[model samples]
Target: MPRRASGPRLYLDKKRRQWAIRDGANFIRTGCPEAKLEWAEKLLAKYIAAKYSPPKSASPPIADILLFYLKDRVPMMKSRSAKYNVANLEKFWGDKLLSDVTPANCRAYARTRSQSAARADLEKLQSAINHWHSERATLPAIPKVWKPPRNEPRDRWLTVSEAARLVKASKRAEHLKRFVLLGLYTGSRAGVLRTLEWSWIDLEAGTMRRRAPGASEVANKRTPPIRLPRKLKHFLRRWKVADGGQCKYVVHYNGQPILRDPWRSWKEACKAAGLVGVHPHVLRHTRATWMVQRGVPPWQAAGYLGMTVRVLEATYGHHSPDWQAEAADI
Candidate 1:
């Protein structure tokens, strides 16, 4: 019998000093330097995904569907959570086939992970299968990925004193102080603040836009421009002057951009402040609750927070002094 055919594989072309895909007799240059093995592997994976045309009635391995989406979609997501979620999903479901995505298996997966995390992971898994089905015309059908019940929206928010203590405790890390202040004042999500740059801030105009100029908007993650509060405006001016030309991101550490979530430092601040169950996201809730308690109109607050009035009323309305007032009076 003739030797069995081999699939395309990564090969370092020593003479060219670049990575290439070896498909039997042909060599496809990957344009990645020999030192960047990760990039070369990703390129190989993309090439494999592009060539994959599953036959109808075939059940594809869950890993292939995930790798396809990981290569194509996750990079475009607004938050890094998708990448992490996909990674966890891959570890659990990579060995399983699409046909294995049964309710029982999903429940088993959830049992091993936290409710919120498992739900998020399964959501990504569902998206990956959907994405795969959309792209592969030869695939018969997509399998359903069961997800756990979503956790209730957290009701935690900082009191004025707690907010003060957090701010004071954050004094140990200037970047963290700026992070807490920006979160409380602007009501922007922690991800938004991590990606915020000096160019988005207009000290002269007294406004700051969450979205960058000319950037495409991600679905459901709107970042409308926020009018700068006077106190926040003052702090921005001082921070801008202090940052000089050294840093680009508004919330950076030691003149370098924060490439990852600063949760460790945030937790440390919470610990020092004598607070528990507090995280960066609570700052957004705190700001919204404060506005509701102070009698800010829901419409105004919603616009300021880049959310819909309905959402504002649904999530934070209970904090409003007038909430259910007529019902209570009866």
Candidate 2:
């Protein structure tokens, strides 16, 4: 086996007085030290060319971007998954003007949420704030808010027995049963389930695709799918829909679209299940962790769950510590 390249690279075609770029993937595949170093040097030169290039409109007020995000950018979004971002952003940054929306302010907002008693929830908020901040702009020279250097991902994993109980409890909530089971089995975000249209599910292939936010409601967008568990497939088969897949969910309430925050139901379920403070996201965390605990690869878990590995580490990694630590044992 050969060593992998550390990063991307650029090559100087001095003979032609030009530069050529090679990527991390290429150098990684080559797996030679010289190739890796060559790639790194090229990457450095490319970085010099790309650095300090200001946006056409420098310093657009935070208020403007946020307003654009909310009134237009957010509402127009078709994915139910993205609504969570809107809601989270509203919870944190809704009241402030864009000029007041410094990276520091975002960090402070995350910090405040992190200060909550839910050891796991605090980190969840920090991670989410960071996600919202990661869009297009270059990071600020100094963040007004700073994330403390600590790895305190909350423990949201459910024991198999606990999962069984939650699955049993879900039966009592007619509208939410399938949704809860989907969370337990698939570990997808609640928002995605809430806004999922029948159009998104590829029944034959057994995949649930995601349509990223900001695309047209009728636009041709592609969201990768997850393989449907057999139980989930049965649930979908028995599931009824209106003439078109226009209904709001895989489950419903009062024959109208069910619209309730999942947290409320999760809380009630925890109480009934003889548990406490079991956040809805915790259910998601638990499901993903179950995969890792069972020796599933993080990359597989991440792709199935639609999160990055960096994210899996910071958010769901708490449960995998023992598994990860055993590399020493190996």
Candidate 3:
């Protein structure tokens, strides 16, 4: 006696002039005509075989896992920083298998990149691998990666006189003065300020928003409204009225967006100002330090500066007037 077919039943749809496989109530169209019933039958057989095949026991390669994470997880993230880290990770370990990312491999990567960068890459990789393992249950044990010691936060701050000199020297770079002033007063990151637009500024409310409308709120990176200082508000009011109110970006050079790094201009201004090793980020450090020294509560300052109170205290606490007060009391 002939054995019955175990796969889906194959039939031709007269109306559509196509062959289809019927599995229970579902009919999957094969797009083949009735003349190709043999082809449709073979395709159906393969599909049945695949559906019944046992699950693979081996863990996916690191490259495959990273691809999955980027496709499925990265899109859901509100923070662009994760995407940036993933890009760097892909560049470093695009071809490596998950099992190959041992501690030695991590150390090798650290040799090529900075300690902090290497740590971030490894953490991302670990998270991706763990996620894959959770879904597939293939890996017996996740690979261990070495972590570098955290570096102390930078302690560079600018004095009021130095800041004034820098601004005075930035006279040649049309927007550099305003940019410096904003950084000094607001304590916002250079990237955030560089991308800031006039639309996010509410002069009437005496505040400036870091992000634009409809932009994703970056994780742990709040775009809190920065209350304008009296000096900054006065400068911005005059600057806005002077331009005939027609520019889009808050920081522009000759009406063009200062999209690229203004390193050369900044260096020249620093030289003229007699300031050494001054960078745009140092302005953020300076502002935070000044806030602490001037007795601004850590919580209030952190909110205004778009950082956590822990980070504020960790980095700028030494500048706080209350720093080490308990120790002195003892």
Candidate 4:
């Protein structure tokens, strides 16, 4: 038996070193050079839309709607995971029509992904549909994109002793040490730390700006400026002199920015400290836990940690000695 023929898809023309759309025996050139893959993808989306998208009043193929959203909306997103979420969603929903988004199908999608991950992916789907609807003057009633229940916030945080051991173990690697210290003291997410530059640190003002200039400000993943801890300030000052003001990024290897997470060195540090299953984000959790244990006010701690007060209280408030003191007295 012969294999079935595939439909229009992206193909690299190795001879010309450019992207093209393969449609049966013919190739439609994208006019996009090798370096401009995103542009090629956008052009391909236009091709798919022109060919497969239904009339304005009818429900459209899931792929066409998603591709339209990808072309129009995703470019403005601040989240790094947006493209991956869209790709995963496309895999399951590509051939399906918008009318097929039923509760049963949504649950099937959930079963294939982790609880939290499924929720996130479905949320993206929901957003894409909403975006599509908003742009259209008329269409069928939007199908609901069901999602799994939200998972409880993770409870894993390090003890003071464990944090100390991890930091000490990290001392073997200069970049890892700085990464750990900044994570523990400032409670910034790993992404912020990865992109942190020396220019964001203000030793004289005793503050550190977590967000890069001109980066889109995301409400959920806030990156508010925080005052530097006295100890952390001293470390930064010393590191500045040691680096001789040559490095651009704070968490750099040989004065060059790390293109990816320092997972190998981080895992080694964790192993040397006799810790397991403790990823980098745990350091931020540990800092929040410590502050709550010390009876820090939720608003103040939330501000310093670049999270909302409601989130801080919901996740770590129980650690406070005075938590529910008045209510529990009964």
Q: Which digits, one per residue and each the tens of the lDDT, describe model 1 over residues 1-330?
A: 889769999998889899999988888999999899999999999888678754433577887878778777887776778889888987889899888999999999999999999999999998888887776544576678889887877899999999999999998998999999999998998888888999998888898989789887765767888899999998998898898878989999898878776888888989999999886899999999999999998889999998899888988999999999999999
Question: For this target, which candidate reaches the highest TM-score against the unseen true structure?
Answer: 4
1 or 2: which has the higher TM-score? 1
Model 4 vs. true fold: TM: 0.84
Per-residue lDDT of 65 in model 3: 73
Ranking by TM-score: 4, 1, 3, 2
Write candidate 3's Cα lDDT for 1-330 as tens digits.
Answer: 976655577878999989988876687998888788788878888767545522434556666677667766778886566777777878778887767787788888878878888778778888877767776556887777676777667787889999889989988887887788889989988877788888888888988888877777766777787788888889888888867778878788777888765788899999999999877898889899998999998899999998999988888888988889999999
**Looking at model 2, how many pairs of residues clash?**
10
Error of 4 at 10 (Å): 13
Off by over 4 Å in 2: 1-151, 212-223, 241-248, 313-327
Which of 2 and 4 is ahead in TM-score?
4
Give a tens-digit lDDT track for model 2, residues 1-330.
Answer: 988865555555545444455555542222224435665565566454443232322344443334334443445555454445445555665555434645566556666554432223323333433433555343343123344555556775788888888877777776667777877887876666666666677778887765533543332332346888888888787675332455655656655655665666666777778777677776678888887777677888887887777787677665664746777677
TM-score of 3: 0.75
Root-mean-square deviation per candidate: 4.5, 20.0, 9.4, 6.6
TM-score of each: 0.83, 0.54, 0.75, 0.84
**What's the residue-level lDDT of 78 in candidate 3?**
61
